[model samples]
Target: MKISKIKEYFSDEELEIRFKSSTNKRIRDRWHLLWLVQALNYFADDASISLGYSRSWGYYWIKQYNMKGPSVIVLPKTRNPEWLEKKVTDEMKIDLLDKLQKEPPEEIGGGLWSGPKVAHFIKVFYDLTISRNKGWNLLKECDYSITSVRPKHRKSSDEDKDHFKKKRAPKYC
Candidate 1:
């Protein structure tokens, strides 16, 4: 609507009353005052302050007030993507498994997966970036121990297979 038309609809007395009520000293928040000032601009006779504000800013305030009423001008909600919040995926676990299996146990650093090493490998090979903690989680999920323990030696007799019968016989007795 034209400024002249807005002024014709609401008299100067009405505008002053609304402005004073909206900009009450008791109200600590500036948002209400901002909305009132913007609304007043639509009908303001003086062209100085109206011309000072950017047209886009005025349009944005007008659009917001029309769509959501005055309260929406306070602040907008903030949110972060769930994927960025934490990394947990089956593909990451499989990638870790493949790397472990392809490399010899001795070749693998520390004879087990270390968080940073696994994270680096993922970034270098798969191009799937992840944090050290996430890599540790993947190892834990796969039941791979981080400790450095030598492979146990087995006796020839035990490998020959009568061990099951010998062990069961003792338990039965």
Candidate 2:
């Protein structure tokens, strides 16, 4: 119903009195509050000016109430039972760094320690299942570069490696 119609149905003083006298004061408990407000609005027919809440919000609340009942509107409880607040320890990080430094590039199958590889290594070695991006972030935080040192390949007298290298060079450069 329109705001004018709602105002005609009930006065502002009545709405204020109801809002103040509401037994539930937990603002976070949106479900109960929404139900209460909507019920009041329906009964009073003055939903538009009630608490200055938007008409769309009120409509959505009513719709949600119809679809899922009052209890569903309440925020679900989120308990971090197994969540690890602290990140990987300094000692563990140092150990990983030491291992990475000591191991040859060939040991990790050549190329740099990719994000996935680091995550896998951490999971296997330290029994930590961190995301690949998070692993990369840790490496970055430790000022470690994801680069590997490779020995320059020496060509035999018969091999023409220079020809391939020159051919692949950018013409514009």
Local lDDT at 123 for model 2: 74
- Candidate 1 yields a Cα-based lDDT of 0.51
Off by over 4 Å in 1: 1-89, 102-111, 150-173
Candidate 2, residues 15-128: lDDT per residue as tens digits? 355446656643233333343454444421235236455666556554554566545344332323355543688887887777666442453454566667677777776777
| CA RMSD of all predictions | 16.5, 10.1
Candidate 2: lDDT of 149?
A: 65
Best-fitting candidate, measured by lDDT? 2
Best-fitting candidate, scored by TM-score: 2
Clashing pairs in 1: none
> Total backbone clashes of model 1?
0
Alpha-carbon TM-score of each model against the true structure: 0.34, 0.43
State the lDDT at 121 in candidate 1. Answer: 71
